[model samples]
Target chain A: MRIELAYFAWVRERMGTPGETVELPPAIADVAALLGWLAARDERGAATFADPHRIRAAIDGALAGPDAPLAGVREVALFPPVTGG
Target chain B: MIRVFVQAAPIDVGAEIDLHDAGGHGASASFIGRVRGDAGLTELFLEHHPAMTEAGLASLAHAAADRWKLGALTLIHRVGSMTPGETIVLVLASSRHRAEALAACEYLIDRLKTDVMLWKRESFADGRIAWVEEREDDRDRAARWE
Candidate 1:
């Protein structure tokens, strides 16, 4: 499936890309699996996902956990939480 | 009534807030968030996607209305470059009792921090610029409301 991935804050800095569209392999069924697969693609991805606990994910603008299904989501954003007041 | 605005100028929090007491609300609570001169920060810039930011603020206001039986609520957030000690955001809530108004004000700010689409960039004295990262404690605070 094709998905648009977005990054913010530290994740965007480390990845050097704010957003991108990509085709995911069939083995990637959910957010956790997708992160694991991406980490193996390059050093930048590996480092970004190095500490999942500090990272947060949103599927189609709604908060999602690592186990959340991404079957119907066309967009997923990853960031270092939010600090806006 | 709830009011939300995003502007480029300084926010006159007190002037923006006025209670006529059409029904005689007995309590009002206001919160103002200012840019802090972080010892580590030499300069700061704020950037936001206009449409997304408006949507974020509207959602926050709606949530506040749904959660609290409020007489009035106001939320103002500024966009663009801001200096240290400048106002960044303000929230006001009025209710029939102090407890509701105070709790609503706190809830609005807390949720805005986590759910808002706004972003801040800080420049350190060493010539490094970076986006502010969200704190775990802020998320925990918002979670309590959920």
Candidate 2:
């Protein structure tokens, strides 16, 4: 499936880009699998996605969890925890 | 009514209040977050996943509405670089009584601190910059609503 990956804050800084569209392998089942798959794609991903526990996600536009399915979704966001008033 | 704004413009506090202050609600409460100049802070850079941020704020508004019998609620958070004395965020809530308005306004601000997708990078006057971390205090505050 094809999906747009978005990074925000420090996650974007470490990734060297804000967002990108990429085609993925079919075996990637959910958000957790997608994170692991992307992290193995390159060194940058490996370094930034080193800790899944520290990472948070939003599937499409709603805050999602590890079990969120990526099927038929257009966008996925990854970032650190929020720190705003 | 739920209104969420994530923008680069300054929050017009009075105008925002007037937009929803159509009587009936006997009590209204607001919270403004400003850049603290006294903390050796020079600038604050706010970043977020655009669509998700708004959606998150709307969800927070909905949650607040559900928790309390809110008549009108507004959440406005600014993005981009901001200096000292600038408004960073605003949470305005109104209800027929003071207790609900106060509690809901406080709840919205407290939940927003940890639940939203916004992130802050602080730049000191000495040229040092750092990403603000999630605080234990914020988490504890949010948990109180449970």
Candidate 3:
């Protein structure tokens, strides 16, 4: 499946790009798996996902957990916790 | 009526209240968040999701309206780059009574800290730049409403 991946704040800075549309391997079925794949893809991803505990995500514009399924999701936004008021 | 805005433009507090006041409310409460020039900070940058940020604020507005007897509601958050003393966010809630208006205004601002898809980066005069981390206190505040 092909999906648009968005990175925010420092995540975007470390990723060296704001977002991208990438084709995913069929085995990557959840947010956690996708993170795993990305972390193994290259050095940048490795460093970004190194501390996944600090990472947060939104699947299709709604907040989602690590175990959230990406079956029919069009976009997945990854970032650190929000700090705004 | 509910108005939500996510823009890089400076927030005009007077104009926003004037428009919101047209609802003929008896009580109006608002919260304005400005970038503070703390520790020689020079600039503050706000980054947000193109679509989700507005949607999230709208959702919060509706939630407040649903929870209170609000006559009108407005929420605005600025994005991109901003300097010290620039308004970062404005939330207005008007109602028939002061109690409801106050509670709703507080609710919107508290939830905004944790619920919205916006991030803040602070740049110091000493050449240090860092993303503001989500505080435990903010989480605790948001959790109170739940």
Candidate 4:
């Protein structure tokens, strides 16, 4: 599957890009799996994906949990906890 | 009535208040959030998912309306670069009574703290830029509503 990823705030700074599209294998089933796959992909993702619990995910656009299924999502955003009011 | 606005410009309180349809309400309560100049904070850069942020707020406004029997509600949040004392967000609620209006306004702003997916990066006076952390207290506060 091909998924579009978006990074915001420190996640974007650490990843060095706001977003990218990547092809994934069938084994990557959820947001956590995607993070693990990203961490092993290369140096750019090493530190960013180091702590999966510290990051949040949004499937397509709405906020989702770490266990959120990614089967139909074309876009995923990873970022730190929101601090706005 | 529900009004949700997400923009990069500063919020105009007077204009926003004037724009609200206040026809059937006897009380209108508002909460304005402004950038803090304390702790050597110089600037704040806000980032949000365009479509999602608006949708998120609309849902929140709906929740507020349902909970408080709101006659009118307005929610606006600003993004991009902002300086200290600039308006960051505004929540206004109108009801037939002061208690409902005030409580709903509080609920809207309080709920926004944790539930809304908006991030902030701070630029300090010494040229240090840092992402603001989500406070446990905020989560605790949001949990109170649950």
The list of candidate 1 runs beyond 4 A from truth reads B6-9, B18-24, B46-56, B136-140, B143-146
Candidate 1 per-residue lDDT, tens place, A1-85, comes to: 9999988767787899988998998879999888887788899999988777777787887778999987878998887766678
Model 1: what is its DockQ?
Answer: 0.46
Candidate 4 runs further than 4 Å off? none
In terms of lDDT, which candidate is strongest? 3
Which candidate has the highest DockQ of all?
A: 3
Question: RMSD for each model, in Å, please?
Answer: 2.9, 1.8, 1.1, 1.0
Write candidate 1's Cα lDDT for B1-146 as tens digits.
Answer: 77888888888866787542315678888898988888667666666543556778888888887787888888899877887888889888888899988998899898988887777888877888888877779988999998
Per-model TM-score of chain A alone?
0.93, 0.96, 0.96, 0.95
TM-score of each: 0.83, 0.91, 0.97, 0.97
Q: Categorize the docking of model 3.
A: high
TM-score of chain B of each: 0.91, 0.95, 0.97, 0.97
lDDT of 4 at B56: 88
lDDT (tens digit, per residue) of candidate 4 on B1-146: 89999999889999999998878799999999999999899999999886888888899999999999999999999999999999999998999999999998877787888877799999998999899999998888888788
Error of 3 at A72 (Å): 2.2
Which digits, one per residue and each the tens of the lDDT, describe model 2 over residues A1-85? Answer: 8999999888888899999998999999798998898789999899888888888988878889999988999889889988988
What is the RMSD, in Å, between candidate 2 and the native fold over all Cα?
A: 1.8
What would the per-residue lDDT of candidate 3 be over residues A1-85, giving only the tens digit for each residue? 9999999999999999999998999999999998999899999999999888889999988999999999999999999999988
Worst 10 residues of 4 chain A by lDDT: A57-66
Evaluate residue B85 in candidate 4 and report its C-alpha lDDT on the 0 to 100 scale: 94
